[model samples]
Target: MSHARRLQRELQKMHQDVPVPGITMVNTENFTQWQMDIEVLDQNPIYHGKTFRLNFKFTENYPIEAPEVMFVRAIDREIPMHPHIYSNGVICLDLLSSGNGWSPVQSVESVCMSIQSMLTGNTKNERPRGDEQFVLGAGRSPRHIRFVYDDPTV
Candidate 1:
């Protein structure tokens, strides 16, 4: 199916199903770009009372290729602090990497839950090493950057 059709089906399912706790679909008007707000459901002190915004940009190649996903800072929203999350909102999760861990079966909701789990399990209250340099030199899309997912334990 075309990417647009697939997205439409996903959107319909999202509206029909009981919403996942701590995960809200903020914007889905555009199939090319969507936004979601995710909160760590657990009592992770570092992320308590915080909601992070995620921006997903889907390409025509969509499920065949992973959509570009990243944290976005907006009014009243700040990026969550995690060792794998950069200061600029670029994430270093293997699941977001097309070559490393992405699969055709993954959907927007699944990605949000995975990210929520990532934040919930994280105890470190800091950005990845060299965050400044990486953010300063990073390109507009996370797909262009080569992130080394060396540490499995966040």
Candidate 2:
């Protein structure tokens, strides 16, 4: 299916289903770029009541290619401290990589669920090692970095 058609269907589906507590669509001004809000449902101190904003950039290849996703620094949306998430909002999950884990079968909802699960299971309140350096050295897009899937369980 065309990327535009598929995205429209996904948007419709997202509206039809009650969004998972903390995850809500933010912007749809243009199909190529979209934003969403994510909040960890658990009482994990690390996330507590913090709501995170995620930015997703889609290309024409779309599902065939993973969308570039990262957290956005907003008024109430702070980047979560996780071993896999950089201070610059770059996420290192394999699920978002086109290399091995990404699949056309996955949708925006599924990606949100996976990230929610990742945060719910995390116990650390630290950023990835060298977060300061990495954040300073990285490019604008997270897709340019080849992140190592160092850990399986968060």
Candidate 3:
């Protein structure tokens, strides 16, 4: 199916099915870009009671290519504290990487759940090493940066 059709189907399914816990679609006004709010449901102290916003940008090659996913700062939302999450909202999860882990079968819901899990399993209260230098030099889009997925333990 075309990318638009695939996205439409996913959107419809998200609306029709029971919503995933701790994951809520905040905005999906168009096919290209979407937003979601996610909370770490467990008692992870660093993320307790905090809601983080995620922004997904889809290209024409979506599904075939992974959508760009990142945490975004917004009203009442703060980026969760994780070693893999940058202060500027760039996420370093392999699930968002096309080369390391992304697959066409993954959907928005799955991505959110994966992130929620990533946060819940974390005990770190620090950002990635060299986060400041990286964020300053990084491109506006995560797709442009080749992230090294070296650490598996969050």
Candidate 4:
């Protein structure tokens, strides 16, 4: 199936089941790009009362490929401090990497939940090392970066 059709199907399912409470679809007008809101359920001091915006850009090869997922800074939302997340909104997760572990079975809901869980499990209140320099200088998309999966326990 085409990306549009698959997205429509996913959107339909999202509306029907609403599996992930922390994730809410913001826009689905464009299948290639989507917006969502994510919240950390656990009262992690780092993410308390914060709602983060996630931008998901899907390629034509989606499902077979992973979407470009990143946090967006807005009036009500700020990026949470995590070792795997850059200050500029780039996230370093094995599941979202195009180089590995991306499977056709993965959906936006699943990814969002994984991220929520990741944040919930984290105890460190620090951004990835060199986040300032990376955000100011890094101009490429998050998927292009060869981020070293330093910790699987996170």
Number of the top lDDT candidate: 1
Q: Of 1 and 3, which scores higher on lDDT?
A: 1
**How does candidate 1 fare on TM-score?**
0.97
The residue-level lDDT of candidate 3 at 78 comes to 87
User: Candidates' lDDT values, in order?
Assistant: 0.91, 0.87, 0.89, 0.87
lDDT of 3: 0.89
Tell me the TM-score of model 4.
0.94
Estimate the lDDT of model 1: 0.91
Better of 1 and 4 by TM-score: 1
Can you give the TM-score per candidate against the true fold?
A: 0.97, 0.94, 0.95, 0.94
Q: State model 4's lDDT.
A: 0.87
**Between the candidate structures 1 and 2, which one is better when assessed by lDDT?**
1
lDDT (Cα, tens digit) per residue for candidate 2, span 1-154: 4888889999988889886778888896677989988889988999997888889999999988999889889887889899999988889998998788799999888898899889999999998878989988987577878887777767
In angstroms, give how far residue 69 of model 4 lies from its true place.
0.3
Off by over 4 Å in 1: none
